[model samples]
Target: MIKFENVYKEYGNGVRALLNINLEIPEGDFVFLVGSSGAGKSSMIKLLIREEEVTRGRILIDDIDITKISKYSVPKLRRNISVVFQDFRLLPKKTVFENISYALEIVGASRKEINRKVDRALELVNLQDKKKAHLDELSGGESQRVAIARAIVNKPPILACDEPTGNLDENTAREIMHSLLKINDAGTTVIMATHAVNIVNELKKHVVTLKDGAIVSNIEKGGYYCELD
Candidate 1:
């Protein structure tokens, strides 16, 4: 379980990105953090990965207070949590399989383990046929799926996506959402921060709406509640 207790975040520039956030997310749950731009969604994601520290309060992941952990332990803590970004940061020259397998290689995974895990990740994203394809050969949706595959190859307990479908058209965006839903169904906690109102409304997943750096509501099977602009 992930719990945010009275969490507050203020940037060095004196911008209060989050204010008194208190949230609980159980294991294997799919949640949509819905909000307009600058609503503190990115701040929460940064805190989750320890890229930024909280100004006040504790963030407990399965009972460990991440805020108090030493800098040396941050890398180990990240093994349990993975993040996917909107840009689909991948190696343009690497094949799909190579991009996904590279994650395990850096950790010294054996060739057999890398092959097995990469195969599973490809299967999860339904891109088995594209394993040998390069970045230039894939569509936007496929590239995002490759990013998703890379994020999940380690089988992290939590997957946080920051505007994952932001770069795709409506149809392609839904395809990306479906791929994410498959990952969620396989028991990984999915926290997707998105502005795709149509997808949010159609999926009817848990919606945690934020406004001005504060949580306005967290509804079960809810749709988008914030204004578009």
Candidate 2:
């Protein structure tokens, strides 16, 4: 559902963050992006989300050329994709239900539809009981789940997560990963960027490794082979 052909991204001061990145993620597939710090994982995501413009080459999502999508149409393009981040990024003052519902509201979903979707999403993440809770009241894992629920509330065709389990304990991380897998099973294309090698190795999913802003390896049913001390 996503493809990048010879993609290159350079910041305003000519710092190249990605180079010749060619990738294809089929619909409903779950893939892991593995890399150390400053290896262009974030850069790839920024390009995908249109947070930064590509310096060269093309990006296609479900056959639509995203690189050429007008600024006015970018919102429409983004409506089909959802992103979760390491920090959760929840509004501090909003309740769990409000946080998830806010996304639908921004998209102009009706009250009844927003309520239904928010509840369904919270259920998916096993957070229905905490719907009225504020972000500060939840544990780190619970907060992360709330972020995931918010991301999927719209039922986006694709989901990209950047280090979703980065800050949690191993067990909690596993739970978060399980939640992501459930989402993947339901047919959303899932791409996760993480440095957690154990999870990637155990899952035996497709893995793309990046180093120095370039793809060092792309393996189907791959393991984490980067040497560690």
Candidate 3:
């Protein structure tokens, strides 16, 4: 559902973040993006989210050219995709229900529809009991689940997560991965950018490894080939 054709990204002051990165992700496929720091993984995510413009080439999502999408229409494009961050970007003052409800509110959903979606999303994440809890009252994993609920409340066709397990312990991270896997199984195309080698190795999923702004490897059912320790 996503294709990058000779995509390149360069920051100001002549620093190139991505170089001719060509890749394709089919619909309902789960993929992992692996790279060291500054290897362009974050840049790729930014490009997909339209937080950064491609310096050259094109990006197509479901055959629509995102690179040429007008600023006024970017919001429409983003409505089809959802993103989860390493840091649970929840509003500190909002309860879990309110946090997820805010997403539907922005898209002009009716109050009844918003209530239904928010409840269903919370149930999917196993956080229905925590719906009334504030962000400060949640554990790390619970907070992340809330974030996931918010992301999927709209039922976006594609989901991208950046270092989602960065701050959790192994068991907690695995719990998070299980939730992501469940989402994938339900047919949401998932692209996760993570450094947790153990989870990547255990999942045995499609892995695209990058180095110095270029793809070094793209393997189906891959492991952590990099020697970090």
| lDDT (CA) per prediction | 0.94, 0.90, 0.89
Comparing 2 and 3 on TM-score, the stronger one? 3
Q: Which prediction has the highest TM-score against the true structure?
A: 1
Q: Please give me the total number of clashing residue pairs in predicted model 3.
A: 0
User: Which ranges in model 1 have alpha carbons more than 4 Å from their true place?
Assistant: 227-229
lDDT of 1 by residue, 1-229 (tens): 9999999999889889999999999999999998999998989999999999999999999999999999999999888999999999999999999999999999999999999999999999899999999999999999999999999999999999999999899999988888899999999999999999999989899999988889998898899994644
What local lDDT score does residue 200 receive in model 1, on the 0 to 100 scale? 92
Q: Candidate 3: list runs displaced more than 4 Å.
A: none
RMSD of each: 1.0, 1.4, 1.2
Top model by lDDT, which number? 1
Model 1, residue 114: C-alpha shift (Å): 0.9
Q: Write model 3 residue lDDT over 131-153, tens digit each, in one string.
A: 88988899999999899989999
Q: Please give the range of 10 consecutive residues that has the lowest summed lDDT in model 1.
A: 220-229
